[model samples]
Target: MLAFVLLMAVVGIATPQQFWPSLSFVGNSLADIAPFLLLSIAIAAGVKATGADQLIGAAFRANAGKAVMVAALVGALSPFCSCGVVPLIAALLAAGVPLGPVMAFWLASPVIDPEMMLVTAGVLGVEFTVAKTLSAIVIGAVGGYATVAIQKAGGFSDPLRGIEVSTCGTSAITKPAKPHWKFWDDKDRMKDFVGEFRRTGWFLLKWLSIAFLLEGLMTNNLPMDNIGQTLAGLGLWSIPAAAFVGVPAYLNGYAAIPLADTLMQMGLSKGAALSFMVGGGITCIPAMVAVKAMTRLPVFLTYVAIALTGSVAVGLLYALWGGVIG
Candidate 1:
């Protein structure tokens, strides 16, 4: 899609000298941000392979309620983008972590993460970043708590009751011998880290490539101007509408940032645009299919419900703020 966009811009500009500036504008935009996308993927893979996710899962298993709150808090602090959060969520779920907390983590991670917050500040300004961060925390905490309450009330059940736990310990031990190991035991941290990097790196790479391709295609081909015009005055409907539009499109969170900027510039409400970008990032066909394969229908639907509700809340809040401010 990046290539196609570049090509089209070149063609468009060559035909009309006035459009030449558009080519440089778009090219510079793409170039300026591509590295962040790559870095997000690498960090995601590293976090997954380093047992960070398992550690989180174990913490959750120890105390479900506290774990849920802690998960929300940690999500706020972590730098992982929405795309980065996906694998971590899957890992937690596979590790028998409860659905409520996982939902919380999913909802909170993208909106509250440090990297995203910084980027949000740059793209939308500090006020918007603070609003998004606060909203994400509130939504994640409420969603997590609500999910737990609902489940305890017998509204949902474990979906992975029959699955076997695959041990990564043995594989961690025999992978390779590395230098700088203490002649004594328990000093091979570097080797262990390297092994983990390889495993998670591969997983993240596969999905990142797919996400980039989808994003590129959307950026190049989707009629952003038309979408902006159509969604202009819908107000509250914008949130759910954005959610609906985002699902099939399957853009990663970071990829949607530029698109969100375009929509906001075109008079789409900030709340609605944010909601759409968040929904597009976390809830998609690919993500749902992945979750379904690992768990059952009830659990999968629970996640979808949490994400949709959280995103809607984000949109509505944005709308409320916009109304007051405007």
Candidate 2:
């Protein structure tokens, strides 16, 4: 809020005539996505307040050959954003949860949460929404199972940095308590709900504002349109190129949707757009920082490799399939 206000003031003073248009662009963009935004916030708050989110842990069951597959699905379905999933990842790894399921969750959790999925569908259409969701699942599964294979080959001998890997056994990260559906019945839970609502709402509002503002600027006169066309003109290389760019883009899941829309309008191919969104979501700065902090350099590097490769592969396959056309 303070940041947005400062932005408004700076724009207002620097170019008084441009002030209304900038603010109005952001305002109208917000209005257009208001329903999905509200639903996203409400559901996230509700899950947090009631502790329903903990259910995702069940996907990482011990001795289950299908754990990786289930984990990938659970990760895609869970509402936890990339940054939000980090603490749980840390907890799961420290609790001796195998690297495979954790890797699956880490890669998939951020790509498309409930909020991201809804907004993506709203902004980019059903095809994009489906592509992004499948991207998450496929990446998570491939990364997860691949890690398991490597671990079996004596790789990732020491995955964590400072975190102590406890002996494999039952723990809280593996088994969560039942959710309190009627959270209001408990004052503490009610407080949790309110706090989560405010925090999530504010966090999303700030990012969305920045995203829409950037979109407005690009739509107005940003020279990036030519850049987009050039990238699109690159043919198949455009997919990997977008995936690489997404690694450093650092845009938030929700924030990236409008940007993707704008870029598509500027001539980005559908596959390249998906690659950008998927790759960016996985390697967003916050999540990368968290991964670096919690894991050793090899693990961090491996994580990046998996994300980039998976994103490119997803883009390539989507392109080959004609991106929802065939």
Candidate 3:
């Protein structure tokens, strides 16, 4: 990625005047989103440091249906990225938490969060952000309950058949000790919080910077209307096409936002945009790899099916009722 950025920089240097617009676009995007992005990161750090995530996981050690609902809601609200959520999923499954709720959180964790929402609203619109948030929760709940039903029907003889507790690495990552939020009261936690803040802030900065840069380059160089026409003219096919394409070719959620906005500007329908986000964000290779590593083949395949089906279903609903809802 760094190499690609450097290569683009060389290109920009060669056409210095033409690249100025791209730079300006990047600047504007940064300025617009900086405050919301910082606020979100602070909130996420506080949540993580306070052991809220572990508390949520602990709550799932009860009745299946209620567990699934709680897990789904946590997944929707928490600011966990796929990479961050993987260890938690491992811990939950290894500690005898049911597969249904774990799968629910896994499917929804990467799709949206407060930070992602603010960024989306800044780059896209409030409507897109709101719909995407609702879709994330709905997808998680549906996937969880569906897994429960499947489990009850003898679909999974032993959901954790091949999974080992040792494979979970350590509980520390998944279940951090309850923290003292006051900065001075716990020096160790404060250090941890600061480190997390740095890491997360850097992660967001790098990816979102890349996204804005790409957006700028595309906006300045591409004939977006021509490309948009190709995608837009597909009509109903566009929704599934977006989902299918997104599954295999997804970048991270942060990067996808600017790209989605660019596509919308070029004439992509709201449904197609939503489908692309759901498919790509939920089924991205990293998230899938994490799910596969933690579950048996049958469970892994079921997750894939759920993600695709839910994405398409949500897309169809939005396409049908988006105008009335708006």
Candidate 4:
């Protein structure tokens, strides 16, 4: 997408001056999130270094059904970005963690965090922020449970194809033995932490740099007035349309808040705004690319399907109660 946008500029479809906003947008977005991103990455490194993955693996191994709910809650609280979370997901899966709860955490972690929640509240209002936070957990649980049910029904038996599974650090088969709770006390473990941090941090910087660049282009070029007008008061179709357009049209979660607020003031339906946020936040380009690397075709497609379906369903439900919420 970023390449395509740049191509348009070179071909005269867009002028050089058009990118001025894009450059500023990219700069500001990075400036706003840089500190938080570093903090989240550091926290994730601590989780990986201290053997928390083993503890999480134990829970998922114990009862998959119960773990799905727990995973959703944990995902909401964690501030990790999609790329940062990918390494952790790989570690968990290779360690024999159940797929159901892992999916929950993956789907939810990118949508909202403590900093994001406060930002949402400040920009979009308390009610919208609260609704969005709740939506994250609901979307996660729904995706997780749906994956479980589908697996039980003989779907997704072998989700990975061509990707080799191996324990990241020590060996191929991760034993059920307890991890040294103070693993970071060892020199080898400190090395492991530094390696993990570099790996995940570099992945995040590379992908998100591109994603935000594309976002900047879209923000400056896309004619959002048409979207706001199209979604205004359209009864049933508005919800699905919002979710559908959100997949490709959204910038990112933080950028979307003010945009959604503007659209709402322009007569966009409340449900449409909500649906767009959930849809875009979960399946954003960077997140999808991260998931694609870790999952097979079937699992990747399933993730997309669950996100779209859940977003549309939630949009409809909220629309039905528009008399009150609106």
Highest TM-score against the true fold, candidate: 4
Candidate 4 regions exceeding 4 Å error are 1-32, 46-52, 81-84, 118-126, 158-175, 181-184, 324-326
lDDT score at residue 2, model 2, on the 0-100 scale: 73
- lDDT of every predicted structure (CA atoms): 0.62, 0.76, 0.71, 0.75
Q: Score candidate 2 by lDDT.
A: 0.76
Q: Residue 273 lDDT in model 3?
A: 87
Better of 1 and 3 by lDDT: 3
What are the per-residue Cα lDDT tens digits for candidate 1 across 208-245? 44444334444555676787777777767877888767
Better of 1 and 2 by TM-score: 2
lDDT of 3 by residue, 1-326 (tens): 48436846875878877566766765787676566566656655554555454444444544678888788889988876765675456546644567788888888888898888999999988988888888888898999999888888888766764444322223333553554557436676576567656766665555555555654554466554565567788988888877876665566689889888888887788898898899778887656755665567898888888888888888888888876776
Flag clash pairs in model 3: none
Candidate no. 1 TM-score? 0.66
The CA lDDT at 105 in model 4 is 91
Clashes of each: 0, 0, 0, 0
Candidate 4, residue 285: Cα displacement in angstroms equals: 2.5
Ranking by lDDT: 2, 4, 3, 1
Q: What tens digits encode model 2's per-residue C-alpha lDDT throughout 1-326?
A: 67768888987897788889989988886686566556656665666667665553344444434877877898998877775565456556644667888888889888998777788888899878998999999999999999888888999998887665655344333566778899889899889778866765665566667655654654455455565777778888999988887765535787788888888887788899889999988987656766776788888898999999999999888888884567
Ranking by TM-score: 4, 2, 1, 3
- Cα lDDT, model 2, residue 4: 69
lDDT of 2 at 219: 45
What's the distance in Å from true for residue 215, model 1?
Answer: 5.2
lDDT of each residue in 1-326, candidate 4, tens digit only: 45545654663454667566655665676677677667766755666677666665665666789989988988877877655566667667755577899899988887788888999899877877777778789989999999899899998877764333333443223444456657668998788779767876776666565666666665556678887787776756887888877877777777788888888888877788889888888887768867876688899998999889888888777777766655
